[model samples]
Target: MSHLPAVTLNNGVAIPQVGFGVFQIPDAETQATVSTALEIGYRSIDTAAVYGNETGVGRAVAASGLLRDELFVTTKLWITDLGRTSARDALHASLDRLALDRVDLYLIHWPAPATDAYLEAWQGLEELYAEGLTRAIGVSNFLPEHLDRVVALGGTVPAVNQIELHPALRNRETAAAGAAHGVATEAWSPLAQGGALLAEAPVVAAARAHGVTPAQVVLRWHLQQGHIVIPKSATPSRIAANLDVFGFELTAAESAAIDALDRDGRIGPHPATFHG
Candidate 1:
């Protein structure tokens, strides 16, 4: 059985704290990689329509031989599908691609404020949740301003706000805002796209001190902070190593050391102006 801990959403659905992400994995490699993750005890899997690998993800899930309820699959609505009618239709298409009747979580991929349609798109998500197309609904890459507007616009308070978060890019304000509104914060790019961030002094030191890999140290830091993290890897050893993080602990000073590494070090697009 998977030993990963679970966090309950506002809507009462429990999601695994650590998940596998399929952001840039090629469509050809997605099925095998995702199957590896599932075998390694990852219950949550994060993907998106724009990633162009939903079909591969579906194939892997179909072949896993696990029950439908055993997995928590999450996908997003791309910027192009931001209207009530289009967003609703897009979800049906994503469901078709995923080969599932309903997804565990479906989110507005980006605020795409330039289009001025996220609010309308959120309405679409509400309709999807009510119609039972998804078990839970949320948003991604949303800042406080965007989240506040969603709350003010009035509907189901988003159950989650997936954002770009890592030790080098703490994003405390957005995380705090989500907490203020009872929205669970999920971390994407949780390891800062790997490589450079993992080799940093603090991360390396923590790994040495804890007898773990630098990636595990970083992921453990995210877990200790109560943020859901989805770290992706195609290598079998790395994928298995990422899940071996639950056995250790970091002290308050050690956690703070990593937290202090935030240098506005966001490697992804900024939420305020990124429309795509």
Candidate 2:
């Protein structure tokens, strides 16, 4: 089993640097997929209420035979449920589905600024954190302004800011903002969905030089930079391969080469404009 390194959050909670993500995996298939990931040594699992797979994640955890403390489970509150009372209820509903008393981490799925309710949601997350419903609280798909707003509220600083980050879309500004506020930056699409990015010159050169796949090379880039990355794949071979990134180290020139590939290529919704 690969013993992955962990990044300590500002709140003193430790999260595995590399984790398994079930973004688009259907609820019915989530159990077997997550089960495979667990069997292959992935201790961190990232899902969301909108994914409709918390039940499956719960089932996988229940059946994995691993101790409760042995795994790190993360789920998010959707935009539609963005208020103090609504967020609390949503978390309880999620807890029931996850079959656990408390989650390792809980994130606001999106800012949904137009709704003008994320602030209330953040406050609610603060309360949940205090109530021990979640060990830590954070946000996802949040931009610099959004992060600033949360910090300005003057409660608990968010422990993390999960974002759509990859070689093609480095998102340096938002990441810098999170860093400025002591929030850990977690990369969601760390591989850019495995299309043209894997075929890029720098990624390919790194792969050939290291005798590893392009995906592994890209994952190493994120890891070497200290970003928390979650790369998901339904294929068992790929799932196992993604966790095998801890074996190699990227040199300075190679890392910079991949860094230059950033062209503001964003594959997901823009955090600033996305209402959900």
User: What is the C-alpha local distance difference test score of candidate 2?
Assistant: 0.94
Clashing pairs in 2: none
Which model scores highest in TM-score?
2
Q: Give TM per candidate.
A: 0.98, 0.98
Residue-wise lDDT of candidate 2 within 1-276, one digit each (tens)?
127799999999999999999999999999999999999999999999999999999999999999988899999999999999999999999999999999999999999888669999999999999999999999999999999999999899999999999999999999999999999999999999748999999999999999999999999999998899999999999999999997889899999999999999999998778875
Clashes per candidate (backbone, < 3 Å): 0, 0
Compose the digit string of candidate 1's lDDT tens values, residues 1-276.
346698899999999998999989999999999999998888889999999999999999999999988999999999999999999899999989989999999999999887669999998899999999999999999999999999998789999999999988899999999999999999999999648888888888989998999999999999999999898989999999988898999988888888888899989999889987
Error of 1 at 130 (Å): 0.4
Task: Let me know the TM-score candidate 2 reaches against the reference structure.
Answer: 0.98
